[model samples]
Target chain A: MDILHALIVLANFIIVPAIAYGSQLALGALGITLVVGVLRFSNFAHGETMAFGTMIVILMTWLFTAIGLSIYPLPTALLALPFGIIGCIAIVLLTDKFVYKFYRKAKSTPVVLVMASLGVTFIMNGLIRFIIGPGDQRFADGARFIIKARDFKTMTGFKEGLAIKVTQSITLVTAIIVVAALFWFLNKTRTGKSMRAYSDNEDLALLSGINPERVVMITWIIVAILATVAGTLYGLDKTFKPFTYFQLLLPMFAAAVVGGLGNPVGAIVGGFIIAFSEISFTYAYKKVFTYLLPADWAPTSLVQLLSTDYKFAVSFSILVLVLLFRPTGLFKGQST
Target chain B: MTGGYGTGADILHDCTVAVNKGEIAVIVGPNGAGKSTAMKAIFGMLTMRSGQVSIDGEDITNLSPQDRVAKGMAFVPQNQNIFTSLSVEENLEMGAFLREDDISETMHQVFDLFPILKERRKQAAGELSGGQRQQVAVGRALMTQPKVLMLDEPTAGVSPIVMDELFDRIIDVAKTGISILMVEQNARQALEIADKGYVLVQGENRFTDTGSNLLSDPEVRKSFLGG
Candidate 1:
């Protein structure tokens, strides 16, 4: 009974939250990796793209709720997701056409494109802040918990209980579907193969009659879809704040770099690594360890590796360490 | 034709080269002889300031290299010719990217011509041996089933035995009624099998004749054939 209680406590505190957070990071990292692989530049604007998409989803969710529409167990934001995706796609394509097209035509270097994207980052940052007013927004409206702690305790006849948020379950399921669909598209479809070919060798792809503009356009569309879904899921899980989304750029970048910048599989794995690392380190082990250990041997201190406030520091440290030791990342993806 | 790279001087001075239907035309010259430039000019990669490149008298001088592929021309460059990261089958599939028609038959033909490629179809093209990668490059070009196939230094870094083997495959391709235009560093062996040969010197045609005629010419033999 004691061991089971300890396990349940661990699950409630660390496992569930990390899995949910990891899925969000995985989607974000995939978007970054795809852009890096296909477009050959690290887009600094990605965080803002997510923010803008989430902002649109929040606005649409508000409008829907105001009109008395409800999905009950599912967030109404799910209904507004397509609109978010459309808005994100429009902005990304317009940015590509008005901005990226010039650099590509001039055959500018990747560094130049990187700098251009930094410029794009500022523009999008301001645009999102202006539209959303730099405040936290409430969009999540659904049955809150899939498995309530109170019900679990009553049913199990145990001192410890486990809870699972509906949003958490939704994030995991949605990420699996998106990732599966993405892999299928990349491996089995014509356009997907062409994109991979283009990513491998641009000149050869052109020689093979693969259109560059079409590939670029398609990449942005996919990136937008990924960013919007990830941002919305994250917003549903936590508080929706533009600045918080912007700050997520560091962890998302760390995840991409750690996974291998241009490798899709690496991104997903990297996401979970970052999330588990952050959660496990920061979580206080006072209760779970108390359950497992004899009362005399129990730790008086919180037994946390780092304070929860220092969570972002963990990502930064991992990023620096990986860069120093293995710049190509675990999957041997493109460096930088 | 006369042109060079971007904003550069003309590398080929009014150069003209052609291959007949179902014949192999080999271009051979010393280093920096602009042998590849002439081939690129014919393929519309360079801006031909004064001459026209035509296939069956349909002037395609203004056509981009991609449009030329659509017009039944496939070019295999000397280096980085194959998509290294893709599987051999994917490389061939990518070759037929512009085709709306089914490509299973064309892929089958490619596999038939290079039986080894069929075995390694699932393997990454980069993992193949040097000779096999060249075969993949040729096989990829052949996927288009073009009327004209241009190869630039097809046997560049491969062994002598592989060179001979590639030459045999080139002959097989030509026998299928597709014209072959190739730039070669192996002048003696290339001219030996050539139906027609162009010995270019300083980007101009120094000798243009039947393969045996050039091989037998005293000046051509002394100057080029290392006699």
Candidate 2:
């Protein structure tokens, strides 16, 4: 292999996918961070919430597809997304009213809220599994690749080529749109200011006449939108399964903590870092790095830092390293 | 007994100081005095075991801090008084969260009162100095257009130079016809501008008189004033 071939392979296989994956993780992490910071609890059920929202979109897509209404060139799920978001918001609001609201009224500690979220998580997990049958579902179709690898090679006349997937483009674009909307809502609006104030100091926020319950409701709604977008994008990129969705908790949390949980921009940055590290470490560098080393020294068995199967371990290790060195994460989140 | 209470840490034991609609009433005490506790009790931040707190003669002894706020009472705590992460403008807006009116006019008035804050309107409240932070806290309380503004040790950590300036602002706020009830660590200075002054010690009233009378009192001067 030559330097040109290696570089192309690295860019095509590692860089592009990492950015899309990071964007997905960032959106999910931001939702988790907000819940923890403002609501003062580590919401264990967030992964399941993402799953639930995506499941709704998948179900809606199936229904729409059956009715002969395809979006064409884009996944029909894209059209079903708004309805999915609404469903997610309703579910979250209802959960807050019945479950979390009681704990809040009693002034329960954050740990208790964490436990409550765990219970909610289990319930949502069970509900999704029962309804969606806990199986991998391929709901995305119609123009799966923006540029096929064969097409890329033909176009460029290079030994290596660049390929972009339709799902990957959707992931990047959707993440950008969602993040921009979120920041705008948080920084430039009255209710958004109230939410930040409430997050900063709940007692003072109350004294300032902010309705805590209302802020919580709004927070849940925003979280629902982010979760739906994240989940759908992830499913579109990969395959959707209830079990896999539930298992995403570790990476999502790692992303949030690495980015400095509760800091929005930090979560985004953290997501990219985690995604890139996972990909770069697991990527079989024999194809990419064989070009750089001497022929004898390069005699290797897939020079990879870790197996792809251990992706979760990578996230956990990074999370532990971050916590040990910088307990507040990359950003100085709420010490209060 | 203090503020009419016979036992316990009754900071305002048997004490009754009224603002009378538009007067500045200052409460002065030693370091261990219950001045702040009394204010907290009045504002419903502390539970009153047995005392009546009223506003315009309506009983509000059991109201929460939020309820008290709704009933036209505003309190500025001595510490952590404002949302530090929020911008100066946001902090002021929070003060008027319950008001449905267009508070841009009130915000303008607040800016005029504290011109420095106006220059740093977009800056976070946490970045401000002690005196400026105190101004934000006070300005937030004023947004409610309350009948009475209760302040807890407004000059506690402020520099002496800034303390005098803050006092001047307080006096100016008093002229706006809002009743002022302040707990002061700087007893002499606080009493000087006060329409009525109450001296408390060990959770009980030590002296009650006009500001000049209390300032000149031989006993008050010996204990709280370091005379």
Candidate 3:
């Protein structure tokens, strides 16, 4: 019974949040990997892309609320997601045309493209902040809990209660559906195969009659959808603050690099690895240990490896270690 | 043909080579002889300073490489030709990308030509041996049902045995009534199978004749063929 209680406590604090956060990170990392693989640059503006999408979704959600629109038990933001995606697509396409395309035409190096993306990052950051006023926005309007703690305790007849949030469940289910759909599209469709071919060998893809412009357009559209979905889900789970999304660039890139940059499967596995590490390390595990150890033998300390405030440090350390030891990352993706 | 990379001086000067339908044309020369350059010029890879490339009497000099593919032209480059990350079947599928009709018949045909490829159809091209990778490259180009197949050093970096096998396969492909245009480093062997051969010297056509004629010529043998 003590063991069961310990497991429940672990689930309540660590497992659930890690899965949700991992899903968000996976989606974010996918966007980064796709751009890096196809467009051949690390897009510093991706976080801004997410923040801008979330800002659009937030505005649309408020409008929907003003018009007395509600999904009842579900968040109204879900309905506005498509609009946010479209807005994000437009902005990304515009950036490609005005900024990245010129550099691509000039055949600039990847470093130059990275610098150009940083410039885009500043512009998008300013735009998002100017429009949204850079404050925390909690727009989640839904049944907040799929499984309440009181109900779980009552049903299980246990001292430890397991609570699952509605958003957390939605995040897991949505992530599964989205990830499955993405893999299916990439593996099965003609355009998807061409995209893979383009990524594999750009010159060969052209010689095979693939239109580079079309491939680029499709990639940006997919990235927009991914970024919007991920950003909105993260917002629903936590809070929508522009700065928070901007800061997310760290863990997101870490996830991409650790999973092997430019490899989609690696990005996903890397996401969960980073998320679980961050959560498990920061979580005070004295309770779980107390359940397993005799009271006299148990330590008085919190048994937390690190505080939540230093969460990004964990990501940074892992990123550095991975870069130093295995530069190709876990999946041995393209070195360039 | 006369062209060079991006506003540079012409590498090829009045270099002309052609292959009739159902025939094999081979280009042979020493290193830096502009053999590959002439092939690229015909494939629309580089902008020609002054030249006319025609396929079945239709001018194709102005066409882009993609447009050339639409016009029933397929080229297999010497290096990095196949989609390395994709499976052999997927690589072949990408070959027929522009086609609107069913391609299973074409795919089966490719598999039949390269039986080993069929056995390892699910394997990634990058994992294959050098000779097998060349087969995938050729099979991918054939997926378009091309009228003219152009190859740039198809047997490069392979063992002599593999080279002979690749030449045998090239003969089989030519037997299917598609005209083949190829540049080869194995000058004598290439000429043996070629219906027509051109020996390029310093980007200029020094010898253009029937394959047997070039092979039997004393001057050609002493200079280019290394007698």
Candidate 4:
């Protein structure tokens, strides 16, 4: 019974949160990986893109709430997701059209593109702040828990109860669906193969008769979708704060680089790895040890490797280590 | 033909080369002799400042490379010719990108030409041996059902045995009524299979004749055949 209680605490503090966070990071990393792989640049604007999209979703959610319109037990934000995605698509397409296209035509270096994207980052950040202001906004309105702790205790008669949040379950399910659909599109479609070929060798792809503009348009559209979905989900799981989204760039980039930048599979695995490490390293394991150890054997310390305040630092440290040792990342991605 | 990279001076002079249906035309010269340049000009890769390129009586000089592909022309470049990360089958599918019709028949034909490719159809092209990669490159070009196939040094960086096998495959491809235009470094072996041979020197065609005639010509033999 004690062991069961300890496991419940561990699940509530580490496993559940890690999985939810991992899913969000996975989606964000996928966006980064796709842009890096296809567009051949590290887009510093990604986090801003997410914030911008999520801001639109929040606005729509508030508008729906004001009109007394909602999906009820589910958040009305779900209904507004499409609008957010469309807005994001418009912004990304316009950015590509007005900015990146010229540099692409000039055949600028990747660093030049990266610097250009940083410029986009600032503009988008300012735009999002100007529209929404920099503050935390909570929009989640669904049935809060799939399984309540009290209900679980009544059913199982355990010393400790387990509670699973509805948002956590939704995050996992949506991530699975989105990832499966993306993989299918990439592997099974003709356009997807062309994109892959284009990413592999640009000149050869042109010789094979692939239109450069079409590939670019498709890439932007996909990135927009990914960015919007990831941003909305993160906002729903936590509170929507513009600055928080900006800071998310670190973990997202860390996930992409750690998994092997530009590798879709690597992005996912790296997300989970970073999430679990962040959670476990900061989580206080004293309760867990108390339940597992003999009465007198429990440790006195909180048994936390690091404080939650340093979570981003964990991602940064891991990224630096990965870069120092395995520059191509764990999956041996393209050297670019 | 006369053209060069960007605004630079022409790398190719008044060079002209062609092949009839089911014929193999080989272009041979030293490095920097514009052997590849002449072929690029014909394939619409470079702007021909003073020449026109026509295929099957259709003037295609103004068409983009993609447009040229639609007109039944395929070109295999000398380097980075294959999508290294893609599977052998996927590479061939990309070759048929413009075709809306069913391509299974053409894919099977490609497999038949390069049986090793068929065996490793799911393998990434990069993982294949150099010889097999060359086969994939040619096989990919064939997927378009092209009327004219252009190859740029298709046998580069391959073993002698692989080179011989590649030449045999090229010959087989030509036998199917596809005109084969190729630039080669191995002048002697290339000439052995050429129906038409153009010997380029300093970006100009020095000799144009039947492959056998070029092989027997005293001037061609002394200058290019390493006699």
Candidate 5:
């Protein structure tokens, strides 16, 4: 009975939520890393960009539902993903054209670009709040679970049985597919190599005949895709709220920095590490530990190190520690 | 390709030096001698402060660096010469980025010029040693198929053996009828291959003569060559 209860809590609280949250952080961090590595700026507006993307997806989902289109078991928002990505891409490209391009041409310092990105972030924040009315919207429906908790218990004939939500499964599978595609694009494509070249050395890249404007355009487009996918997957797993999405910036930046700011692989690893730590530390471990301890040794109190309210502090402390010991990040990211 | 923007500051001070087709023109000077500045001024990296730069009898003083490349002027900067993260072939491809036509043939020509690069085509340029990286840099510049290929201190910081090998490649390149304009610190060896030579000091032409004339001249021998 004790072991079954422990397994139930573990499945429900630790494993499932950790993966969903980690995938979200990975996607967000990937966007941040790409911009820092290639475009050479710490884009404070990235969180707002994610919010705007989800806002677009929500609007599209609403339109599709209004028109009487039914996606059935799968969420309707999935069908509208392409439109959301396109819209997000256009917004990013326009931002680059109007704001970033001038700084690029003037050869402004990267810190200045960071400030500009903050300004854009504020504008994007206000814009999203205005359009979405700053409220949580439950836009997902249909096929809610791959394995319902009751079905799992009846099939296994055990007190604890694995229950896989449809959204949870989708988040893992979608993140895997998207990350694989991104890696392939970066390592195998011609334009991708050109971006790496530009990131490594700007003057030489220019001298080599690489079109700077074209590379910049493609970077924004790729970032848009990653941001939209990350944003949508996150909204699907949890409730969709504008402010909640904006607050994700802290954890996303934490993941990016902990992994080494400009390293893609590091960001993914860091995301999972951060998610696991946040969950494991805050989780009430009495149920799981009860199985290992002798009858009288088991304490009455829950063995949680901290409450869930302090989750943000966990990410922040980890970021500061990584910065203090290894400012370049775990992957030895280029400081430039 | 001329316009009415008259030469203003005379940074290059009405210098008339020439290298015929298929000849090496060596420019030599001490540190801060305006040697590189002069090359950059012609390449449009710096707005010449003054003086006309004509390429094959066309005034190109006002052209952008990319436009200069289109007009068959390839400049190899002294440092930061190649895209370090890019593979050797991709670096060459980037060199030919402006060309609408296919560049496979030009790439083959570069491989033939520097056979070492062929062996490391897939290797990143940054991983190569200084001398080998210089070859990649030169190969990238050659992808443009220019009428004139200019190099700034091609043998700088290289071993004596590598310097000799690089000089041989420079001569081989000249044999293909592509004019060479190189600035060098190794004055004596550089003058050995020079058909024409210019000695610059304090941003002015101090000596203009045939390579042999400057090499044997007492004034040139005393100050530059440490004879």
Candidate 6:
């Protein structure tokens, strides 16, 4: 029944791509979760923040390429990532000081903070467009594939071939490292625990002598790091477009909410789930079913659940359902 | 001292409250009497228009609430006192957030004082029963090993049995030579264990005397102690 071929097809088309996308989503959702927990508001500007960071990476990558700086066999963007992160840090910190801090000092409601973030989203959106020209920018330049489809086919003697991209591998590895470091920072370090304490009870944290401004600054720095890494890896795998990153806000939020808003582990889990669902729903499973079924029973139709254009709708649907059923999310995160 | 939250009406006016080392001073008043507000002002949680907060004669009126913690003062709020998501041990660790030195010995002392907290040290503070949560909150305040410990209705929303147990813990804490300044809703029970009591009405000190003396006073008994 050609089960091996079916599996290879699925692996080539679904599993590998979903994993990378999930890792990227997990990183994005993490940034959102950290802001939600400590700042106690839904940051509407998250997508634009990612775009801003990625745009910085793209510009740096172009400059590096112009200067003939090459990390060859690895994208030069890898070298530019830290610079992008620094830029991101500066931008976000400036935003906090100039805008968010005013509302915070006034003891504004979280809803006001959220609306302010939405306003920030527009400004950043316009800012990125102004600088980057709102066009697709490709920075990924490395060994394109760890194992090419043709090579895998030749080696395995299978009709269906599997391919693994270098960028995908990098995305997976970086995600694992980032997530491990984040959890360690949250659980083991003094400042991290203080942030958690601040998130848990602001008044009590102040009573315990945890400085609020320092905590806010640290949270922003951490958000900048996460957003940059996530955005860069995503831009490396996909193409960097300011509008695309803005659109990505929806799925990233879905991932965050599905996993549990303000719950870090939940963000990771939610990322993978949304990624798989989006891919699976849009995938045409004709080839897989053809390989698995007998010749006489082969279907003529594509057998896709939905068109690729509806991929984001899958996240939207899940988010709506989760909100309706379990508002706190699967991991029992903050209720409202 | 005279102050209120956000420059609102002066809830506290010429309210003078003091506690001695190793002594327990209980502030008792009816609801809306500004008992918690007075404690909050003393801890620098509110702006005092014309008042001075001192620690061993050092004027701390200008110090922020966070700075006051550095001056060896710990406060336990009535609600949302503990970091609910944090484990009990983490809550204690956070309490000692300002302490740069080793806190293991202090942790051990807290564990010994509240043995149940030691057992549930790894558990999330929010998941604990109400009484246990109160213990965790107190343990969190004790982590700083401060000279003065302030509690705002520490026994709030607990059963009478849990209240008695909490009062015992408070007495045990006072025995460790830390001054305890507490706002309590249970006037009779609080006055019984307190070394000194201040009965406040409309944010003004209506009665100030030794605990036994206030408990024995017929006027205080009739009005506050519910004789």
Q: How much does each candidate deviate from the true structure in C-alpha RMSD?
A: 1.6, 2.6, 1.3, 1.6, 3.1, 1.7
Question: Which 10 residues in a row give candidate 4 chain B its minimum summed lDDT?
Answer: B39-48
What are the TM-scores, per candidate, against the unseen true structure?
0.96, 0.94, 0.98, 0.97, 0.92, 0.96
Native-to-model Cα distance after best TM-score fit, residue B56 in candidate 6, in Å? 1.7
Error of 1 at A285 (Å): 2.3
Off by over 4 Å in 1: A1-3
Which 10 consecutive positions of candidate 1 chain A have the poorest summed lDDT? A130-139
Sorted on TM-score, best first, the list reads: 3, 4, 1, 6, 2, 5
Rank the models by DockQ, top first.
3, 6, 4, 1, 2, 5
Model 5 — TM-score against the truth? 0.92
- State the lDDT of candidate 1 residue by residue for A1-336, as single tens digits: 788988999999999999999999999999999999999999888998999899999999999999998899899999999999999999999999999999989988889998999899889989988888888787889899988999999998989889999999999999999999999998899999999999988888888899998999999999999999999999999979988988899999999999999999999999999999999989999998898999888999999999999999999999999999999999969987
What is the lDDT for A27 in model 4?
95
Q: Which tens-of-lDDT digit does each residue in B1-227 have in candidate 3?
A: 88888888889998899999989999999999999999999999887988899998999999999999999899999999999999999999999999999999999988988999999999989999999999999999999999999999999999999999999999999999899999999999999999999999999999999899999999999998888
- Candidate 4 stretches greater than 4 Å from native: A1-5
* Candidate 3 docking DockQ: 0.90
Model 5 has an lDDT value of 0.85
Interface DockQ of candidate 6: 0.88
Better of 3 and 4 by lDDT: 3
Measured by TM-score, how close is model 1 to the native structure? 0.96
User: Candidate 1 clashing pairs?
Assistant: none
Error of 1 at B15 (Å): 1.9
Candidate 6 error regions (>4 Å)? none
Error of 2 at A321 (Å): 1.1
Per-residue accuracy of model 2 over B1-227 as CA lDDT, tens digit each: 13323344444555555676778899988776778877877777664556688999999877888989999889898888998888999899989999998999999889999999899899999999999999999999999989999999899898999999999999988898889999998889999999899887777777888888988989889887899
> Native-contact fraction for each model?
0.83, 0.78, 0.89, 0.83, 0.64, 1.00
DockQ scores of the candidates: 0.83, 0.76, 0.90, 0.84, 0.56, 0.88
Q: In candidate 2, list every pair of residues with a backbone clash.
A: B2-B12, B2-B13, B2-B14, B3-B12, B3-B13, B3-B14, B3-B15, B4-B13, B4-B14, B11-B203
